[model samples]
Target: MNKLINRLVLGSALCGFYAGLSNAAVLEVQGEIRPDPSNPGGAQIINNTPVTGYCTEFPGMCGMLNLRSNTFNISFHSSGSIPVGHVIPFGFPATWRTFTVSHSSIPGETAEIQIRIAGVGTRYRLSQKAQEIVGLPIGMDEFYYHTTLWGASWVEATPPCRPATEWGRGADANGTDFTVFWLTPEDVTTCPKSPRYVIPGMSLQRLDVHYELRAVRPEKLIGGNYQGSYTYSMGSDFDMGSLNASDPSMTFNLNLTVKQDVKVEMSADRVYLAPKSGWMEWITHGRKPEKLLGDLRFFILSSSPFKMDLNCERPGIDTCLISNGSHQVPVDIGVSLPSPWVDDTGQPIARRPLKLGGAGLQNIKPAGLPNHLPSLLHFAVPQDSVKDMQSGSSYRGTVYITFDSDI
Candidate 1:
């Protein structure tokens, strides 16, 4: 009579951490991805920096940047000082342009940064004011009172800098926000060197910037700390429309770290092996058991693609062995994870053989995060091997299962 004599146990380890870069006057942007039971998304972007120039006066614009989950915000804080030596005021640079950012840690990977909206405060003073200042049409003064003559009523929606233009990015402002004109992106052609740049002595007091980042999705990349940076010329380019200003440009450094949160909680760490039903028929009727089987139940939550490694106390050529005082036998192990957790090719992991060197569990990502989902670790002894075991002999061995995401 063969006895049900095998017992299996469980254990775990983690390898992940967060990282960032530091510099003075180099505007830094940081974000992270941590395990959260409530957040169903892959990663959540956080706004670490405060909104100084825009948020205070332009609450509507600040709210717009935060409306999207992926949109991030940062403050420049410093104003562009008009240079004293430069005599002529250059054309207000093409207000909008695309910024290409490259990853600092990950080579050959890049992302696009677009200025969704922006605001700037300035004192639009003119050397002379008269009936000529009244050249701007009367009906143009619709939304905000444009105090100066060159740009009378910017509140009127049209031409460029209007909040409703397609390429204009909903970026528009009247002179109402304390002498600040809010606008999107437009080059020399649309908003040419007309009344826009005809001013004599104006100084930029504040410049606020908001950006929409098209970063590489977390699912497509492995887990680790990644960083990137983008520098913008503060002249007539998109970032800050100052043709002649004190600060020439600013650099935005992005840092994103993800500590792939992989957890396994065992409901029953230890399990005792038995024939399909029990030892009753095998003991009473002397019938040879078809197969010996047992299983360990667990709950798992892996935030990124991960692999599992297997180890043994008694190693065999292709498998592991369990032994009693005099006899030895081979045991096979497998695993099954529930829905939303699939292999690299999007297939289910049902009874997949758990090999000694992590052959079965490699590059498995989730359609949705696995939130403590019920799982099983299966152990089996083949009938062919069980027939050779001594009757009433108890065999013992341990199998180590490792869940790793650094792969």
Candidate 2:
């Protein structure tokens, strides 16, 4: 009877020891949602406590959360604009221009959260004074703004937030004036039915907002200064238990300015004439004469009509005369205008070349000359005209080239 009692007591003790071992928690699962530092406008899930040791039971739950909670915050890090110096032509479509907006979020709990965007002032306009000067039509809008969810492939939002749809101007704005996008977990089965989910502790996810602007009536857009502003609110529908935090929102001011201007530049400050040996000599019977002066290259950029003039510094100095203090040799002057320059788009424009003549004010109106016109000037002395002149004399003269805008 004593032996039987001892065996029964030992069995009971062993059972209790096994139960205690099974109930002890080994690996604690703790994480949160937060913005990823490496990736702009993105978030990632971070483990609060270094995950170590092994789970003997329910191993999957060792690094997973079991409840939904609002433990995340959203903030913007980077913003970008359209290409600098990009000219928006009249009648340009909304599809031609785009601006990228980026933001990130931090989630505290391991549940799905919903993200929605709201904005104020969608249709921006130039200053009232500018509108009057440009004679903008009544109720004429200058720019139309739109937003879309930026995904691996841009996903078009439905109805009120449709792609390319105008976001009207206003102060009182709501979801009806914004767009909605989802930040889903890699394993859909882990957080099914949740709009956006994060691991426990601190998890971060990066996102992007695509904003596009289109010129409503570019024809009425006068060249001057113009500007506008707008406010955007990024709201998250997550249960923030007791933490007192402000909702994430941002305001962006949209502005643009157009100026009518022109730039003209000459390749060289002073032109040098070729040596006497390089000049066309009557002795070279059949060889063509080389030009006495090198071609002058002119680079012009203009948005309006312009004129170029070549004038001799001294009166009656058009012809080059070499004198040995007794006799003189007269070298007749010749000017050749450059051919019309062709643009990159294969457009042909005519650059009005001035006719050669004795020195005076050689006025040239380059009618039909396209912007960024590359022009050249040629100078020469007719061999026949100078054949009767004596040689062995020094000559010097000055010609001034001037460019004027006729806007």
Report the number of the highest-TM-score candidate. 1
CA lDDT, every model vs. true structure: 0.50, 0.28
Per-residue lDDT over 261-368 for candidate 1, one digit per residue giving the tens place of the 0 to 100 score = 555566754567777767786778786847778777776644456677766777765566777747667778888988778887789999988888868577666766
Summing lDDT over every window of 10 consecutive residues in candidate 1, give the lowest-scoring window.
12-21
- Candidate 1: TM-score? 0.54
RMSD of each: 11.1, 33.5
State TM-scores per candidate: 0.54, 0.27
lDDT of 2 by residue, 254-365 (tens): 3333222234455554444442464445345533444343445656443222333434433234433433345443333333333343222333334333322412222232
Look at candidate 1 and tell me the lDDT of residue 159: 35
Instruction: Give me the displacement of residue 284 in model 1, in angstroms.
Output: 1.3
